[model samples]
Target: MVLRYVRRHFKPLLGIKGLWTFRHTPLAMYWAKLALKDMLVETVLKDENLPPDVTNAHWIAHVVSYAGYLAKIRYEGYDTNDDSKTHWVHFCKDLYRIGYCADNHLPIVPPLNVIQQKQEWREWIIKRVTGGYTMHALTQQLIAYDNDTQLRKGTEVEVLDKFSISRMRVGYVKEVIGHRVHVRYWDTDADDQDLSNSFWCHEQSDAINVVGWSKTVGHAISAPAGYDPAEIGNSSVIKKNPGVNIQVGMKLEAVDPLKLSAISAATVVKVLKHGYLMVHIDSAGHALTQTYRGVESDANHGNNRFCYHVTSPLIFPCGFCKENNIELQPPIEFKTDNFDWNEYFKATGAKPLPLKDLEKEVIDHGFTEGAKLEAVDVMEPNLICVATVKRVIGRLLRIGFDGWEDNYDQWADATSCDLFPIGWCQLMNYDLQPPHVENQEPGLKPVSPGVKRIKSKSGTASRSKRQSATSSSD
Candidate 1:
């Protein structure tokens, strides 16, 4: 029996890679067998006398044939683009071959393609889990940081670069399960409003990554339509960052100390790197920057100095609270009711990069699309993001944070400290951020340059197996 065979050989199947993807393998195989039966019945009817005694060869053939069929129908022809169609087919054949070997304990000789896809799928699944809110709070409080945030419903947010790639966009949280938040961006098209189909990206301190999940048959969400948001302003959350310097103004999502439960819109009022940042909660109607010290944790308990860092989940881009329809705590009633950011940060204020200046920088630096680099995270200034230059505007690079999907990208200035040489992190002895890569090495993260393509609104894109480009300092 299949069950007996599986139990006897369970150790081998467990030892094989991609065992989790096969968590639902039986269900998938069952459906494939249903299709096979139809084909078999048709064949028997045509022959009129073929015996129904099924053999092990028949089972193996069925697995290969069905895998091939799934390859064509399910995975969008498995990367059969242009002249590489034959290569793609052979790759799928090798995948099936490996799957067969993993199950049967046959001498497995995996091809470059099979060895490759297994690596990719493994990494992909890991990213999906870490980038979503499915983990427990204690677990999150422990990882120090990750790809996404612990975003909850009704939280207004301005996700400029944390979980999305853009100048800035205002959105409201519809729901949060584990690590994924179903957000409704008011500026998005009708297609983007649907929560179930949307690919949600999770944010840690400085960077984020996207994980795709189903809206149906899982812990998905459906936010109420026509729900009006209160206390959330409709004005543009785009404010000129006064300083792009070490002691400069950077947009950060800061927790409103007054409103501990809500995600208040805040920014770096003062930057004191190596240990401190003075944050001002603007949209939440708070006054002045609150000083925060990073890296100092209780020696005995391991509790960090600031509950969150500049890249902390507690803080977000300016205007996050309003964008998400969450109310900001109103500033004290009568004393200096009006606040002027431009005047406040006049000396060392932050400003968004101009179109022409950014373009010139891109050309000067040769920061072409798909170029790789080490980037400083604006939120977690101390850490280096193993990144790629996703898009090149005149002088700015639309940056991709991690993994192959292009969803968790951000916009950064060409001359900002945020972008650095590939080996800067190692040279400085700072810990490089964890990768969303498959079989990645510590220092070198090489990726095959995927052709520049438009990123989908839902954050879903073709994840054809890509070989990462390793990094080396000259």
Candidate 2:
């Protein structure tokens, strides 16, 4: 009703009495953002072709266009209405005029009744709904995002600041410029015509990249896969300290599991015997930003007890995130239940074991590239399959799953319990899952007998030593 009265009386004042000065007001700016966002969204029926990419592009274009107009208005000293708004260059000549309230006395208008307000809102919504969108639904969600965290490349984000067609899509940041983002998102939008299309997005006022207290949800930053992870398991020996062992612990760089980016500043905390360590990051969020003066918001706050192998790529030296220009997020203080890992290890017998002796065993076994073997599928522990050695790199054997794509292939460190010799599955009373080719003959012919001897010898000896060492440490 206030808006209605204002529009009625303010029409005359609006023409030469420009209102764009409200751009400086925080409330007005926020209001404008919502208004602009809502203006681009259309209510459609369930059957409507609401491809996320098209919708995203549409909304992005709207924001850019509006931003451009605002920029023009600020740069040029001109007031514009629907009519009589001359060329954009008019403002370039003069300073923009400012408008302010002159008196405390305001025009009194009849207020809207509660029922009338509801009716008006219902009508407004009905007007926005198209012909097909009136269909009913079972569940409706009204999720509120509290924070609009700054976005950077590698942020794990879901699209919904929702004017775009790609609303609810989950993806990682591929690139970003200013307020615009290039999201490599994935969604099951089968009906969407432009599912594969890349959409440029302008960040929303309430865009949330990370949550402060949601433990069940995913983190705001995504660990990058572009870098090769450290392979300590492939090596028989590693230094006691991180960064120094691989590269120096005090200044070593590592991937922040809470917010994965290129790298973050971290210090070694504790060296777990089984190829892992506890680390403390100075700041997980803004790890990418260069430190010119003061520390960040989350600096030196948590134990950040992430256990990483000596060769894990997640660890890195200071300034790694900044040097790479990767988007960083404040580390989430994940709330987990307290439990003693030592007791759990003793109970389950699943303690992490050192790989040094196992590496020597694999090397001594004479297992080389192109060697064939039978191996257990970690995803399906009950199944064993024919596998081929793709290469011998360091202390790990890169094995390709036979008859299966490389997606299921693996790099098995000598200490990994997953690998086995040919016919070992048959010997264990576990059925083997061979390749489904009718003409397939035995591929690991020589490996079968040799594998039996290696398994009974080095494999058994390594297991005994690993158990004994872990027990002694415990």
Candidate 3:
């Protein structure tokens, strides 16, 4: 009935014949369902005078799309008994009301006493349906909900401040907007008791933690409030403190940060705590810039330098690419095809970090090809879209967003927080952005998996020989 209604009323708007050409394609079908759902939410659900049966049919369609079951239902058709249908209608009506409130920027009304037992669950549903919470906030809320200790305004916590070293400062939660939390610091020196020094950060940031985190880590708290740190318990979320023993002047082959496809010789210019290193690409052919007090002239060039944790998958031992039969982008002076690691290191007086140190940081991601997941669009940070693991390279993953062109695909670390498990959006009550379909051309040919294509300097498509590695370290 919903499909019949859509065909009759929206056929001209959606070009039914043209859409049918790609009915077999998952991207096309998903795009169509998203279009239908948006139309119903923006138009059909807003009409209060619409008949119950008609509204119910449209609601059922919208629900199906939201749940991502449109593809199966379109072909298999859905059947429900009278009781199930009634329950779904009520649920859909609630979803519509929540959406309406969000659209109008109105506060949601509390439920009556009769339905108070499920009030908390309903509020979570409201947040999910409205799609207003950030990923961090949603995850925190889920954790809090399970633990029955939701963090709200006035919650005392410790915020990590990293300067020359790390210090935990006492602060109170002022406000939470999406993933950002405004923390008002307690000033001990101010006689007037000013609490105006506040800043915002992601709720799940490693820098932010429960009140007693500093004690567990043996870090001194910069608290002026004279509060008893001993009374507070450790944070629920454990901080990642992996040991990495990299030092300055260490040489490694790293993926060029600017041109991600190329691997080049790099030197660590600065070594910081917690396995982080500031590496400068060798002989990058970029202009040298002056640094503070002329301390490191070459390091001042922003394009030539990149920050990476010592255990990063992008950085590897000197001869890694050569041993794996992968192409390497050598320094400007060396021939790309004939670059020798031994001679290059000898002339530069560069020492490669021991393989033992690098091995400790290597993680087993357990990701396989063709697996479906929700991945954050790095270019568009707010969007968590449907994606597939197109390829995996040693601790690196090639993520291709669904319904998007290959040009938008990105390479990410296997342990990157940007990648989430399937159904994460649903579990968090966040709305997943539908795969974009308008950009896809008709009769598009799929590229062969055996070859990798890259755009050359002359703006032409060129194929690169892709070598498959048997081990994750390769």
Full ranking by TM-score = 3, 2, 1
Give the runs in model 2 whose Cα sits over 4 Å from its true position.
1-275, 278-362, 436-474
Clashing pairs in 3: none
> What's model 3's TM-score?
0.45
lDDT of 1 by residue, 1-474 (tens): 211222233322111111111211112122322322112100001121112442222111111122211211112112434332221111111223213333555432222343356556445433433432211223222222322345656565533222222122355656543233345554455345332222233332122212211111111112245433332122222112233332334544444433233333344544443223455544422332221121222212211112222323244444444455444432233124443334334634554211111112123544566545555433333334556666664454566755635433545545443554433333333345544545644543433443453322222232222322112110
Decide which is better by TM-score, 1 or 2. 2
Please state the error at residue 356 of candidate 3 in Å: 4.3
Say which prediction, candidate 2 or candidate 3, comes out ahead on TM-score: 3
Poorest 10 consecutive residues of model 1 by lDDT? 37-46
> Least accurate stretch of 10 residues (summed lDDT) in model 3?
69-78
- Displacement of the residue 260 alpha carbon in candidate 2, Å: 18
lDDT, model 3, position 78: 18
Which one wins on TM-score?
Answer: 3
**Candidate 3 residue-wise lDDT, 215-274, digit = tens:** 654545677655666633434454333665577887788865544445677778776544
For every candidate structure, what is the RMSD over all alpha carbons to the true structure, in angstroms?
A: 22.4, 28.3, 15.6
lDDT (Cα, tens digit) per residue for candidate 2, span 1-474: 211222233342111111122221112223333323212121111212223323211000011112111211111111223233211111111111111011222221111232244446445433433332211111011001211236766676544312121113455665543233545544433233331333344343112233221111211222224422233342333323323342223334454433221234455655555344555553423233222111122223322434455554334333333445433222223212433324434654432222221223323334556655555443332245666667554444556655554545554554344554443333233445554333434442211221221121111111110111101011
Question: Candidate 3: deviation at residue 82, Å?
Answer: 23
Q: Return the lDDT, model 3, position 87.
A: 15
